[model samples]
Each structure stands twice: as structure tokens, then as C-alpha cells.
Target: MSSSLPLSGRVGIITGGARGIGYAIAKRLLQDGASVCLWDVDETALSEAKASLSSLGNVATAQVNVTDAASVEAAVQTTLAALGKIDLLVNNAGIAGNNAKLWELTPEEWRRVLDINLNGPFLCCRGVVPQMLKNGFGRIVNIASVAGKEGNPNASHYSASKAGVIGLTKSLGKELATSNILVNCITPAVIETDILKQMTQQHVDYMLSKIPMNRFGQKEEAAAMVAWLCSEDCSFTTGAVFDLSGGRATY
Candidate 1:
């Protein structure tokens, strides 16, 4: 099926494209024939990722902090200027919030999570939508988490932030559905990423045990979905939340 993938001339901007799932998605998009702007906070990783993806296809790098509105706005503009079009926007920049119980979590940590996970998407959407609406075509896929749907005991902040992303996706999706734009979200179970390092063994154990599939999700699988959703193939779905939960989620 992938041999006939249809995104031949799209331009995309993927936040957090420095590494992990974001980089995986970026690579997949390029492989499917898309010009990409890989944005991230880590300058070094962004450079490396850009260099790596350039060998696959056209890829540009931007060092921008998604949590900062000004930085995100400028980055969005730079992407548009450099690419000449913005066919896809993937709001994949986020941090795993504090793992403490809700009552024990600090305000700083909570705000950090909210700012990066929720507000970052908000800023990106706000910045990119006008261009999309102007062009009368756009595809946005936000990377949420299964934790958002079923709250985790120790990850209250992370869970809440993702829930907020889901809410944001729904609201924006509805608002833009009248146009030729599509907005969607994906809820993925534990995929292999450095974020796992932020979790305790007990936390990881609990997550693993709850998975009916009994294993971690692969980055390629999720990346495949992201690439498709960012393509013209996803015309019929809007305001939807897809699950890549390894059988751990049902609804």
C-alpha cells in the first residue's frame, strides 16, 4: 500500500522533529515525497536530523521553542517563507509532564507541561490556520497520548495536558471543517522514546502491564499513520482521535 503513497508535492512542518517520534514522522513524510521543516528546541539535534533527512529528500531545520509563542510564531513564518507553502502541520512538540501525584506536583512543573503540550499546539494552529484557510487546503495532526483518555495516577499533569490537546483539536477541527482544512489527533500508547527515561520503573511497569498487546508501539507504525493523516488521503476524517494503543485502548 505504501508503494503507491500519494503525497508527492506537499510541504510540512513538524515540531520536535529533532528526535524520537517526531523525527520518525519527519522521515516518513520525506520518504513519501514531502518537503519538510524540522523544528526543535535542540539546535544540535535539529541540525543532525535535518542533515540525515536531507539525504532522503528536501529537509530544512529550525531551532525554535514550541513553548514560546513568539518563537513559534516566527518559526511558522520562517517555514512558510522558506517552503512557499504549508500543506501539513504536525503539532508533535511536547514534553512528558511531571510524574508526581496531582497533589504533590509543583506549579512550575505543571505549567511547563501545559505550556509545551497544550499552548504550543494552540500557538501553532493559530499561526498556521490563516495561511491554510487562505490556500483553502491544510492538514494538521496533533500527537496526543492514551494517557489523556484514561488518566494515569502518577502522571496527572502529562495526562491533563494531552487531554487539553484533544480538546483543542476538536474545537479547531470543527471551526475549520467548513473550509478545505482537516484537523485531527492521535492517541498513541507507549512508543519507544527518550520520554520513557522520565518515568519510574513502577510507572513503566504499570503501563506495560495494562497493555493487552504486551509490548511497546513501534515508531514506524505511528509515523506511518502520521504521514497518511498529513496527506490528501485523509479527506473524510476531521475532528477525530485515532488510536495507536497496541490494543490497550478501546472505545
Candidate 2:
């Protein structure tokens, strides 16, 4: 590891850190010299990810249900006890609910997706913001989606959830701008991650077709943007939306 890495001496909590884009971000942060705690609801995946990432840097795992207040509070306490202080928060835990139009979707399905995608981040922010305030420094990066910018067909719930995330990021960013706790989000186009498994083939093809790049993005690519946002170099920006859309986003 390079001594001059940007994130050296930093510690981060990554929700949904067990797999997909979350896993990639954890690995990147570790490589950048930050100790990371992988927070996930999946104990099995957490074990596997911990084993795989332990060799790279300091790593910890905790089973967390981001949608639950008590669960998030406990995870925060555990991370603080283990890592001592948290410098970064990556709200990467979200689910792609079933693919269906608004009329076709059940209330249960809608709430489930919103609970994890929107409420989860809200809980995490509530849980961790005080710690950041105490330290007088922090970076929060929410993993929003391009779908949030332009709602996708048959994925209304997922799109709405991510849009809420973006709204949360902007509002929080402004509130904390003077406190040095930066809050921002990335709107990435379709990335090739396990979340894709939940989407139908037709939906997948439609997403790909919308990307001007003519391809799905890689998890590593999203991680790279997130890494930069998590670093001190991103100081001037907060309450902002970054585009990782493969030219799919016009605004």
C-alpha cells in the first residue's frame, strides 16, 4: 500500500457491503488505505466478503438491517467500538423490487423497496451523523441511480426510491455544508451487478439500450467515482449529484 494514499487513516461503514457494487466499493476503500466495516443483512455473504477483503486491509463485519432503527444504532455502536471513529458512510444497501408498472405493483412490493432503498439510508444517516458531527468531519455518499433521474419503465418503485435518495442527499448536504460533513450522491446507469438478477430480461435489454455506451457499466467503475467522493479531494462539492451514466443522462 502506498503511504500517500488519499484515504489513509480513514474508516468507513458500507451498508450492503456483502456483494455487488457495495463489495467493490469496500475493496477500493481498503486499497486506498481505509479500514472498513462491511454492514449487511446477510451473515453468509458477510463472512465471505470479510475473508476475501481481510487480506487487503483492516476489515470488520456486522449484520445490519438498514431499514431498522435499533439495528442501525447497534451497528453504529459496534463500528465505533471496533474502529474507534467513522470518517465515511456509504449507503449502498438497496434492492431492485419486482419489475412492474405502477398499476401492476402491489403495495407490499412498493413499500419493501422503499424501506430498503430510502428508509435504510435515512436510518443510517440518523445513526451516524452525530458521530461525524463530534469529529467535525465526514463524507456521506449515497448510491442513487440513473433511473432516479429518468424513471425507468416497469421499475417505478425502484426509481422512486432512488429519487428519494437523491432528494435526501441534497437536503442533507445543504444542512451539513457548514459542518464539514459532506453529503452527496451518484446517479449511475445500469451497472452489471447481482441486482440485475432481479430484473427481467426485457428490462435489462431496455436499460442497456438506453445507455449511449451500448453496454452495462462495471461495478469497479461505480466504485471509482465513489472512492473519489469519499476522499478529501472532493471537499468543494456537497449536496450534489454526480453522473455516471455512460452518456445516458442529459442533465
Candidate 3:
């Protein structure tokens, strides 16, 4: 891939695009050549991200609740109305609840984690598929986690939710294989982001012990992979899960 690649005419909608990995994806997409629609739940962060990313290229922003069917529908409609087409969808919004034993996790905690990590993608995909079908071209890239694969201790809900995302990606990718759309998921381990601050110290220590590289994965590393999966070069793969866990995982 060219370091200075361009995605000139494509329109992309990135959920949870206001910051972190989402922001990096949005920035990379714009740098490539796509028109970007940034959707996030935080209004202030959305506005700030819009301003910071405006220097890239054609862009827009929407405060959206990815887990809410109505909110997702409205965001998709607004995107199509303004951009006129939806070529890429990055379902990157997610939440990592406090790390605790499975027995200690409450019903509400499990529901909230699943709502954003798994259900959010369901809602966003539901909102975008019809439009994609009409155009016969769409790229969906989901951000999952290494925990989903190995099942991290004290993070039962998060693990299960990301596991569901992987399952969803595989199912959707096959379901849409006959069409122009392609769906795939990426699992990252110990990314250097604000989300890390939310994890317990023990959680961090345990994760680091497993990461053979003994370092956090950069957001740009993940963004590079996501950009490719969203690009024209991603023609032969769907329903696949790629890993960005440094030396921590290989399968």
C-alpha cells in the first residue's frame, strides 16, 4: 500500500469516530480520498474531532447511539442524503466494562457491554445494508479484540461480546458474498489508547505478560489494516478475522 494513498470519491461512515482508533481510521480514510461521516455518542467530542479532522477532506459528523436502532437509522439516512452513497462502514464503537469476575458482573453491566460491543454493529449493519444492496458495493470492517478469541479472565462480558462480533462478521460476510459488499473483523491486543486507563492494573499486567512483544500496539498499526480492508485491494477475503496482537497471537 502506498503511504500517501488516496480514496477520492468513496463515502465512508465510521461509528465511534470521534476519537481513539476510530479517529485514526477517519483520518486515514480522508487522507486516502474518501468522503467521511463521523458518528459518535459524545456531542462535544464529535464536534472537536470534526474540527481537527476537517483539514483532511470532505467530512461530516453526527452524534449517534450505535446500539439504538432508531439512532443508527437516522445516521445512515443522513449520511446517504448528504454523501449520496455509502461505500464503507467501520463499526468501531465499543465499551470495556470494569474487569471483574463473571459472578461479580451484574446484569446491567453485561447488557451495556453487549449493547455497544455486539449489538451496536447489528444496528449499524441493519441501517446500512439496504443502501449497500441498492449500490451493490459496500465494505464493512469491524474492530474486535484478542480477548474475544482466548476469553480473558475477569472480562467475561467483553470477551463474549467481541466473540459475537467475530461470529457476526463471518455470518454477514457469507450472507453478502454474492454481492459487492465484503465484511471482516480485526482483533487487537493491548492497543495504546485511553481505553487502557479503564482497565485495572492487574488487568494491564496480565495482558502485558501475554503480549510477547511487551509493548502496546499503536493505533496507526490497527488503522493501516482497517484502511486496507476497506480499500479496493480487499477483493478476495470476507468473513475473515485478522489479528494485530504483535507477537502475542498467531493463528
Over 1-251, each residue of candidate 2 has an lDDT whose tens digit, in order, gives 67799999999999999999999999999999999999999999999999999999999988999989999999999999889999999999999999989999999999999999999999999999999999999999999999998999999999999999999999999999999999999999999998889999999999999999898889999999999999999999999999998999999
TM-score of every prediction relative to native: 0.97, 0.99, 0.97
Q: Candidate 2 at 239: error in angstroms?
A: 0.4
Best-fitting candidate, measured by TM-score? Answer: 2
Model 3 segments more than 4 A misplaced: 1-6
lDDT (10s digit) by residue, model 3, range 1-251: 24446566889999889999999999999988888999999999999998998887878988899988999999988898778899999999998998999999999999999999999999999999888999989899999999999999999999999999999999999999999899999999988889988899999999989998888899899989999999989999999999999877767
| Prediction 3 TM-score vs. true | 0.97
* Error at 63, model 2, angstroms: 0.2
Of the pair 1 and 2, which is ahead by TM-score? 2
Give me the displacement of residue 33 in model 2, in angstroms. 0.5
- How would the candidate models be sorted by TM-score, starting from the highest? 2, 3, 1
Alpha-carbon RMSD to native, per candidate: 1.8, 0.7, 1.9
Q: Residues 57-137, candidate 1: write the lDDT tens digits.
A: 888877898877789889988887788888899999988865788889999999999999998999888888888888999
